[model samples]
Target: MELFAALERDDYEELLFCQDKASGLKAIIAIHDTTLGPALGGTRMWTYASEEEAIIDALRLAKGMTYKNAVSGLNLGGGKTVIIGDPKKDKNEAMFRAFGRYIQGLNGRYITAEDVGTTEEDMNIIYEETDYVTGTSPSYGSSGNPSPATAYGVYQGMKAAAKAAFGTDSLEGRTVAVQGVGNVAFSLCKHLYEEGAQLIVTDINKEAVRRTVETYGAKAVDPADIISVDCDIYAPCALGATINDDSLPLIKAKVIAGAANNQLKEPRHGDALHGLGIVYAPDYVINAGGVINIADELNGYNKERAYKQVAKIYDSITRVLEISRTSGLPSYAAADHLAQERISMLKNSRSTFLRDGHHTLSRRQLRG
Candidate 1:
């Protein structure tokens, strides 16, 4: 399980790994390419089943980031970090600082922000050890939590997806079923309500569901029932890979758009959605708002610039639609094609392209 060989299989030239003794911290960083710009992505903390799973996740996620940045029209290329452990039981101040020290060692080959199982407070701890972190506490005058921005971007992108699917950009008179009521989903619900869209929401947290019911009058159902609910748009604000085989047959929505990562069970799932006539917003593209906002903060926190950049999601989505319609390719493939083209352009210009499609990755595989 050599990551560099896996990277080489995909034509990625730069991959780096780091570990920390202070907390038994294990981290992997895969930079698909810096030809576009510095690699920027989030840091994910999860109790992976194995080191091989972590390595596979990091490699795939980093590659996704490249395509995500390219399609989002950002100058940054994609990269990702995964900390292998149960964040709940494995996290501590020393652990974060030790991890931050690893990030500092990168010297900028990779830049990180918060991801699943990591929070703004955790990022602040990392910040205490390194300048390479973003999405810190608001007291630091940074953007703090990114859920609002993420949801806003997803909302905007969802509207565009709705337009492509239903022939109108207005969310008015639309019924959307969302599969999570976390911070991002909360904001997304507000966006839908503001746009005259009715909401059907679900979550494991009773308090979150009850509060949403009390405030927005959203219909609450069990998490399992949310997907099968009949609706215009299905928004997934939870974790990735929710739209796999089991849920695919149950989905009653015309458009599949969500802020969750890794929404597809597999690449072929995108084709299945297309076959079902579902207007799918590729997860990496629609959900990139958080990364986009944090990437802007990388140079300096620029609220206006960040918002302006997020608006491009509309065009990015439009391009996805165009590719899907004209070439009959799945939305995911279209987005990947766009990113691959950009990498090719960069590689030709600088004479430094990593392998693109299934060559090999050249890093040591981690085992949990």
Candidate 2:
């Protein structure tokens, strides 16, 4: 890949490749922007098909984190790390410790946390080598698994979307088609079930589906058939690019709100959803609860305060929808606009250097 050209195109700050032959660690760290503060994001461990694919994923996710943090009102920039290996087979204490040392070498330019294939235990291991990791166990005085908090934020965002589309936020009796019943979606289904929302859930993992069905009485369906299912809200708690050309035409849901990232295959997909009168809770805006929860650790973790901040996701969704209506832009575009405006404003407001201290590197320094 043309690394410099890609970074220039996306306005990325820095991208680092870390390799530890002894521990079999091959990782890519992408810091998209640090105008707000140090780049704070999670480290995802996955089995990528190729190194190029891993780089692309890291770059895209890092850019998304910048927007997510900015829109969520956090004084942080965006960054992401991807470990290109099978998490099930490749993870080890030595590998994570080696990775943590690489993070420490960055001198606080990026803070890491648990993501996808990684866990709180992994964060604890990383913490042993560096103090720049969040989302560790309660013993470390950090927020525990962020999935539950993320689910809560998505649930609240879903209700906000319902209010926008159906004139009421109460999901009672509403049918929601959940695309995946992973850790976050499992908790989300519990919330939906308690609120009297009928659930139609699907997942590649049959055991996960079975567990959700047994616990919440969710109706299980084939994964491929989920988009066409009749439902009020299509909650994609799985991976990205689900709302592509093929599934867009078949989606029967009035609202699309879920915990997934990069749900739109392309920018045009967001326009297409808008044309269909679908209320889309911008993925980054709605699913930032995990980041929000973890960011609180920087200020000394407080569950109550963190949850209170997550509840404001509803407000963020409402504002995004309002921007979409007033500006005649797609919801996703509106969210980007809102985040960009804040970033620009902050960049100008904080242009002057402070004598006390600086939490983030200068833009020029970050670019280097």
Candidate 3:
């Protein structure tokens, strides 16, 4: 990829490449924007086939974070980091500490958390080197794991979508086709099951699918057949691009809401969903629970306050749908419009500042 061209096209603020030979850590950090505040996002570790792929992933994820934070009403911008390696095999204390040092070097232009291949334990490791990390273990007075909070937020958003599509917010008799049964989805399934939603679950991991079936009495389906299943909601808890061309034609769900990031393969797919009268709870808006939970750490993590913020996702989803209906735009476009409007207003209101002064400082600085 032409790196500068991509940055220009995406309006990214900064991108940094970090290499540490001693720990064999090679990572890319992309800060898409800090117009709202300091950039904050998660660190994803994946075994990409090429450097270009990793760069693209970081860029796309960073931009998504900007939108996610903005729409979620956080005083933060968007940034993301990608460590190009196998998390299972390549992770070592030295590597994470080295990565943390790089984050610290930014002086809190960016804050990192856990995503995908990374974990709260990994964030704790990063915390050992710098304070600009969230999702650390509760022993450190942090938010701990964010998956359950994210799952809860998605559940709330799903209920909002259900209200939009089925004239009620209850999932009591809804059949939901779940695309993946990972950690967040596992927690999500529990909520759906408690609400008496029938689940048809599929995952690349057969063991995960089997466990969901056994635990929740969810029906098992072939992974490839999940999109076409007759269901009230299609919940994607897996990777991005699941709502693209092929799957769009097969989806039978009236409501689309899940924890996945970047669900649309392309912008047009969202339009296609809107054309079909499908209610789409924007992925970032629905999934902001995790970030909301983590962002609480910045103000001295409080579970009650964090959960209260997450519960507001229902209202946010309602507003997004209202925007879609009144403006005749896809739900995704409506969400973008809302977020961009916030960013623009904030940008104009704070025009005099060259720096946003939203940096995350270490405990020492906080104490001082």
Worst 10 residues of 3 by lDDT: 352-361
lDDT of 3 by residue, 1-368 (tens): 78899999979999999999988999999999998888999999999999999999999999999999999999999999999999889999999999999999999899999998999889989998999999999999998999999999999999999999989999998999999999999999999999999999999999999899999999999988999999999999999999988888888899999999999999999999999999999999999999999999999999999999999999999999999999999999999999999999988766644366644554457899
> Candidate 3 has what TM-score?
0.95
Task: Give each model's whole-structure lDDT.
Answer: 0.85, 0.95, 0.95
Q: Estimate, for each residue in 116-224, the C-alpha lDDT of model 2 and write its tens digit.
A: 8999999999999999999999988999899999999999999999999999999999999999999999999999999999999999999999999999999999999
C-alpha TM-score for every candidate: 0.91, 0.96, 0.95
In model 2, where do residues sit more than 4 Å from their true spots?
A: 352-368
How many residue-pair clashes does candidate 3 contain? 0
The parts of candidate 3 lying over 4 Å away from their true place are: 352-368
- Report the C-alpha displacement of residue 173, candidate 3, in angstroms: 1.0
Looking at model 2, which ten-residue stretch has the lowest summed lDDT? 352-361
How badly does each model clash, as a count of residue pairs? 28, 0, 0
- Model 1 C-alpha lDDT per residue in residues 155-254, reported as the tens digit of each score: 8889889989988889988989988889888988988888788999999889998888888879988888998998999998887789888988998899
